[model samples]
Target chain A: MRRLNQLCCALGLFALSAMAYAGPPVEGALEKQATNWHAIIMFCIFVALSMGITYWASSRTKSTSDFYTAGGGITGMQNGLAIAGDYMSAATLLGLTALVYGQGFDGYLYMLSFFAGWPIILFMMAERLRNLGRFTFADITSFRLDQGSVRTMAAISSLTVVCFYLIAQMVGAGQLIKLLFGLDYNIAIVGVGILMMVYVTFGGMVATTWVQIIKACMLLTGGTLAMLLAFSQFGFSFHTLMEKATAVHKLGIKLMTPGSLLADPVNAISLGLGLMFGTAGLPHILMRFFTVGDAKEARKSVLYASGIVAYFFNVIFLMGLCAILVVGTNPDFFEGGTIGGKLIGGGNMVAMHLAKAVGGDMLLGFMAAVAFATILAVVSGLALAGASAISHDLYARVIKKGKATEAAEIRVSRIATIGLGIVAILLGIAFEKQNVAFMVGLAFGVAAAGNFPVLIMSMYWKGLTTRGAIVGGYGGLLSSVAFVVLSKAVWVDVLGNKAAIFPYSQPALFAMPIAFLLIYIFSKSDSSARAKAEIEAFEDQYVRAQTGFGASTASSH
Target chain B: MSSAMYERMRGNPKFQELVATRGRFAWTLSIIVLVLFYGFVMAVAFIPGTLGQPVSEGAMLTVGVAVELFLFIFFWALSALYVKRANGKFDALTAEVIKQAQKGGK
Candidate 1:
């Protein structure tokens, strides 16, 4: 039956990708162009470098700890860069800039909410997570709670977030490869899946971290260069750039205001809640804490990540503005020479088009390669996190009752990575036309609702029992997914329903509170001996969390 | 590893001071950030028209854009502040408390 199910999934995915390829060519300036050799070469170089890193990492990865945490040898600064790289995917650069090109002030608001998440993570979760966790986030939640149940719940939640996030990245990668390399959607998705699998299965966290670090540096450099070129056009004056942007944009001066994309207050607040808190709950991001040696390094990592991410966002905001003036008004970027016509490869190509306008084909190729690298790096991180949850949390701890050998665990992790990579590719092809940015938001909502509530309660609330955490965690997970399904974004937009049952698209605003309430009520009413024991153990957990007294140390490989 | 060591650390004046000071500092900064961020959200919700208004006569920039920029800088500053204190005073106090606990054990 399981083999049949796997075959069915494979056939379904093939059918989906075939359908997407058979569909009419996307309209606008991006009409079926020849593959850019320059971009392909640059991309090949990047892939070769990353594969070399993977080979090196595989040799060093001998134990479960090494596979999971890179032997906890990463420095604070390097981890910070990797975190920023993991967080600032190509969707952030391209999708966000496109939003700005199309909506102006609304895009800026999104950028702000995204950056706000980092500070909250630094303030609340980073240090404690580093102190408590060893491999996956389950290690932290299972600290004072029932190890079996808590690990199961955490594994489920982690997989949910990872799958959602993975699909979003994969979809973006497909679209990007299609645009840049002129590759078919199916082939692009498969290529990305295969490369990401190789990275995670062979290299594990060490390869993943270095990939992210390299990608982050490339992305930062590309963004900075693009911004500089844009600035040169206006003599490096913000005033002149804004003036030109206002002139070029249809909305004129009003483009600088906040009411363009999000006019509704409730929706805006809900979106804010999702972006801010959802970032804190991300499993892959939390899993990064284990790569560092100590709590201090973890804390420093968040600080550095916040700074680098903030700087990147600010640069992209300006880049997006410059794109409005440069790419939006350029006839070369429009189909049929129509003013305000559909851009090539849609709005997500705005950053790429801007690269072309400012620096021509060579820079455009460089930026495109960097963008592809960005996707590969992020997907590898997500794949690793998901695999760890499956192998470390569920298979090893829950199924084997913590008796699984190190080699067995590592083997399982690699197998899980391959499985996850395939699933992500299929889902990516399936969700190709959906807005990748909004999908990322949905992933955040799920993370915030499901994982964040259980994690926070387990850490701070002594009364939280294993049963309470499970109930709350799953409650958040189900409610978030349900609300999103009922929302206009999914029902009306994606599923073609006439109307949506849920008023808001983002579910975190409602689902998070419900999850918290369930945990509180269940914990308060519980009088079980197990609950009492867990509550009593909270003192020790608190001490360890605060002081890192008995925290896991890095092993010498 | 022992309950006695935990009890000793919890009772120590320096440990108590570290916990109280750090907790209060984190909360204060967090509340400030929440207010600033949520306040901006509220403004965008309730008084969006005001946010749409330009910062100066004939200026292209709006009040909303300017304030968002300021909030971004403020957040970075707050992070730096927290990290500074954490690495300096917090680390010092933590090391001192751990040393005293280990000394007691010896």
Candidate 2:
């Protein structure tokens, strides 16, 4: 409590003094001097509040179940809020919106793919996932199997997904703080890193969930108010806003139509599949299902989540249009839209730039703060999920021989969270200058490649042996990473040098199918793979643990 | 009633009426929700975007986001209906079926 007071006082002093001392840098130096202090202060408040929640939750947690799954006591509504929080990451909040502002209909394709996944998650995965995996995504994949290789592959995939996701979010945090608070990029990265570590280390999933819930509400409120104000700019008429947006389109700058940006059918379709199925395949997202109590309740949570997400994306779509229309009207919005514009980039500043055009420093500061809060909340979840994969699946199972007590596991988890946080901070600092939009795409691609195939096979195919899962999961992981490294997006767009290495940017077309085929082939190879003996033993341990039934009953299968 | 008639309507008269009424309500509620949500989007697209006037872009985004923000409440309403109907109607029928199944009755 004393620390909290000191932190608040320090922030207040910093905000007042920083604004008085800060001066706008010249065009080239703008990135250095544009840190929005208001945003920084707002972001700190959320981080501090989340830490408070984590401490409270940690105190209440008394057992292994409470530590790992929050005793599965979360109400459906709370889970729904967390689900909203989980889905609306920096990628969806900033990347997609920025893409829409610049590219028009092409950007909507991203939202369409993301939004399309919820119904699929509800209908296909959620209920069964809860029924099968009690604590982690690994539970379902390692079922009735040796779990050694499968757990390793899952850990690798989980780490990769979280790393890329953290990079995107952390970079966004740094950029948002720099833009809104006048802080140095390095300081912003360090600040965000420390906050995320504090939240996950002290609180675990409980702290993580509440922060997500609060951020989700703030995001909804911010997004709605922005859209409403955008409409009011045109007298609350959708037609007028469309007319303004369309007129801007007529100036040979198409922001509302699809073909204007994509230009190729293959790229468009692949990008679409990547976004849609990719959301369901995310380890962080799949982990949220375990936090809920029952299989039946899991179904209810997803139903609500889908509806919320579907509507949320629709509003974001309007905000995207508003970005171009309002910014289109005020040339000042994009004094830097191009080579000579005030802002150098087209994507990151769409939300902030639009807010400035509509309101002023206050609105800009508030939106920027919300964006920062979004990044902090998301990175904390990613770090926590990754920590669980390490401490629970690998450390507890392998090193401790599964005899590690709950207290021991929690200790390991906290240590792992701190380690991951340090890595995230370093990566955020390293990649802060690169285009953040690509980071999101890379995260999705990696997840789709590594984890999705392994998960799908494990749940549906009873014949999927441990060997098949290990090979398929690892194979997907390596192939996707290799493909991404060679792809044009990385070589030419990111590295700014071009040579024909990998013909395709998107590898899901080749990699995902190969992953599925490998799993199928391996699952069918050995007669012993279908051994009824092992199935009975495996069922005795994990399946019954989930059903809340006597563990011994399943031993007879 | 004869055993055949009792089997057709179930052993309990109250259970039959509840199923008929709740089933209708469930279907109607689902359809209404589907239409309302889809209608909201269609209207947003055709009704003139909320983007062009004197309002702040943040406010516009907020309003647009709010439209979807209420999904939690919608879900709460759906869950309430489910619990109410399940407790009021579905559970009773389930109990009757269990009793019949246990008795080895048709």
Candidate 3:
């Protein structure tokens, strides 16, 4: 039971973390290719299964509580699997493998950075978040502060992050489908948009969570099958795998250690900090904490999720190494029958090529379907999160001022989900040719600098005031955006400038401090009656956060 | 929660103990993760060659891969350790604290 429970959870987070590294360099190389009928057939089976789950889920989603958090009745084991699904992505499998296939150990280092964020969330933030939050993270952010001001800030920041991330995924889904499944780019974008909307609008959190869980299982199975098959050829020897991989690879022995990818100390540390705190601030991931029954379940889910993330990182790492030996030397997998030539669909197709090499057409078809399913699952999670930020935070709390009925709030969220879906489809097509890889990085930056600082301060600090949170939140948001704009990723790489104005590609190291400083200085100086009451209210918030007293309970209905 | 319930919980000794113990444990584990992770990051940034070297003479596995493998298992073990303690001891204390506070409220 323990192993089964943990297995489901592990598969989920591994999928979510994969999305972070779908880099521009890999996604840019996608060219329209021949439709693999096997891939398309397998993909249809996956779609049918998920839609069936959605049909089952729509019946249980009745109230606002059901819509946002599955009535908070989900077990830790299932929550772990569902939430983990939100983390793993097509980009993670394809991008990380490409990293290993090309640069070797730096790929492992990149995966390590992504995995580092999970533990901190598990240890420090999980219980408090589960105890204090209800439908959205805004509930916690605005728990003590003036709801009108703080919720608005959280909603804006969340929507900004969601929009950027949605566009990136949508564009990624379009290109990846066109390349791997032989579908038209527009058709793929519209397909993803429609599916996400249907799942979120009808199934709500229950459907979205189950979709993630099923996707996690499929991805885990396909990846493990491919990894095991590839490893068997090496006589089940890690030494032989590394030896043969390095011998054939151009990087040779250089792939064994960290190289110039993150050779600069400043960028390495900054990128580390960005990924760590940025994950905690993500609206979608944070929403998962509230899915389980209580703080106890929250802790259990974290334990399982972290274990899965770390374990899957190793799986992806081994798969990358194995690909070097199996796919690297074979001229048939490359363009123009050249061993070192551009991979047929792009470098991101290394894992797919590796799949075909090891397990033949059947396994290749299964992996291709898993990759497509991965995108849809992630998009649904993001859409639900965005919808909650709108209907729960912006609409119900801000406009209705806590007077809105449950039915009205759920109605608003369904409409908002559709609204977000339409905008995502439009933006996906609009940015079809552009490199939107920076969008994911920018999403992390906003989460770290904008949402993370204030959320942490509110949970742990007693002196946080509404004025301080607003100023600090906006300051962090603006500064992080400004820094990313001037940084090398955008300033030089995207904008085609001579040099970057901001030296570091990551803005978190610098932006996080400015946010904390502003919040501290502003909060300390506030002498208003409202500030005094907010400070005193911290006592009850502390009690609730620690003991789950008076917190949202599992819905009986 | 009402102010009276808040006051009752604040005065409850078990509540105080749970807070102190859980707070300390969480931060301690957090610091451990921070130190270990940043240490790896620093090594990767500054001393790539040391990790590039083999674990021993003529060994195929690099120092980097071995250490990474260790960190992988060790970090997850830390998480399990945390859940084991929190779900057992701290949760029991928390339940007791809430019960006592509710009695005082009635």
Candidate 3 residue lDDT tens string, A1-557? 62343334334423422332232222333432343557766877777677777777878999999999999988898888877788888888888988888888899888888988887898889999999999899899899999998999999999988998899899999988877755567877987888888789888999999999888888889999999999999998988888898888888888798888889988899999999999999899999999989999998887777777777778888899999989988888887888898888888889999999999888998998899899999999999999999999989999999999999999999999999999999999999988888888899999999999999999999999999999999999999999999988899888999999998889999999999999999999999999999999999999989989888999976
**Per-candidate iRMSD:** 1.3, 10.3, 1.0
Q: Candidate 1, residues A43-69: lDDT per residue as tens digits? A: 778877887788788788889988999
Please identify model 1 stretches exceeding 4 Å from their true place: A1-33, A433-438
Give the Cα error of residue A277 in candidate 3, in Å.
Answer: 0.6
Task: Give candidate 2's error at residue A275 in angstroms.
Answer: 2.0
Each predicted complex: what DockQ?
0.66, 0.05, 0.79
Between candidates 2 and 3, name the one with more favorable lDDT: 3
Q: What C-alpha lDDT do the candidate models reach, one value each?
A: 0.85, 0.66, 0.87
Q: What TM-score against the true fold does each predicted structure earn?
A: 0.94, 0.78, 0.95
Q: Is candidate 1 or candidate 3 better by DockQ?
A: 3
Docking class of 1: medium
User: Per model, how many backbone clashes are there?
Assistant: 1, 51, 14
Instruction: Compare the candidates by DockQ and give the number of the best one.
Output: 3
lDDT of 2 by residue, A393-448 (tens): 89887667689998899888889998999999999999967876666767787778
- lDDT winner, 1 or 3: 3
TM-score of predicted chain B versus true chain B for each candidate = 0.95, 0.59, 0.93
